[model samples]
Target: MKKGLRGLYYSRNEMDEMVAPLKFALVGKFSSGTPSIARIRARFAFWSSKDFSPSAESLVVPVWVSLLNLPVAFFHRKSIHNIACLLGSPLKIDEPTTDYTRPSFARVCVEVNHLDPLVNDIWLGDDDGDITQKVMYKNLPLYCPTCSHYGHVERNCLLKAPKNKNTPDVDSTSQEDLRIILDKKKSKLVEQPS
Candidate 1:
């Protein structure tokens, strides 16, 4: 009954495509024609830093050593470089090193995704190698192809009324009026001169 409910949730095409090969083979042990069952797990990975030199090769790859214990090893192929023992709940790789030179300071750029996206200032390392101070939020403007203006994006622009180009531009007309008035004033001043 549990197998029938699980099968109903996923389409036959999805079950065939997504089910692992090992799980599919295991299902054959059960009664005639039941969909394969496999428990899914997510593995998250992120780099410590991204400023490695192009000349230096074999970037450090950290892999979990055991599920029972919190430990990882930086390995390249079959060769292991360093074994990191995670003591804290949230593991942190302090000053991840490469095969090449180690930098005294590592500059990192952080971005906040919100209503207005921003790129933070360059983070400087302290004596203790800890980051300090809140970085200023620099607004990144969106470019609209339709109006060719920067600031608010395309969708917001469409809601506003379209500008009429058929009528002469206000700036040009104002400049022309000013020129004519100046010419008339100059003519009157010249005629009054002795």
Candidate 2:
């Protein structure tokens, strides 16, 4: 992975170090003309310079959000930045968007707080008339609202408390109990006629 990253963003004075498992902190001179790092995706991994620590209670991730059907007048840098602010802190705008090569949509990298409900669409224009612009996200991470964290959905949130007392907490379930349950299921399956 390190070699692949070096090949992609080559810099003579670049320094890369592993910060955590499957995570790396890269310090290097990258071309400003290059596409936004948020847009770069390799398999299940994405790149970001955001200060997202492992122990952070709140979840934040850099996401490439596309504002579809945006008016041509709003294609400029300032306008795109303002629109991106409605979603999150604007990180960087794609080259195509700044160059006006892709008029269909304006892509901007934004630092999105996962705890907040994402804006699906937004109204653009004055009081006389308005248009609904669809907001599309690239590689948005799974977020757990209950825990206010990323990497898991609400249903699978580890911090969520059980409604009934009899309902065993998944984490509290003993290894012996799990083994016994598995054995019982296996026996039941074996006893059934094939």
Note the clash tally of each candidate: 0, 0
In order, candidate lDDTs are 0.32, 0.68
Instruction: Candidate 1: give the clashing pairs.
Output: none
Q: What is the lDDT of residue 138 in candidate 2?
A: 95
**Model 1 misplacement above 4 A:** 1-105, 110-133, 136-174, 181-194
Tens-digit lDDT track of model 1 for 59-112: 232222221111111111111111121111222222222211122321122222
lDDT of 1: 0.32
For model 2, residues 62-168, the per-residue Cα lDDT tens digits are 89998887766667576677778888878889987776667798899998887677877766554234566778999898887787777888899766845676445
Residue 35, model 1, lDDT: 34
- What's model 1's lDDT at 155? 79
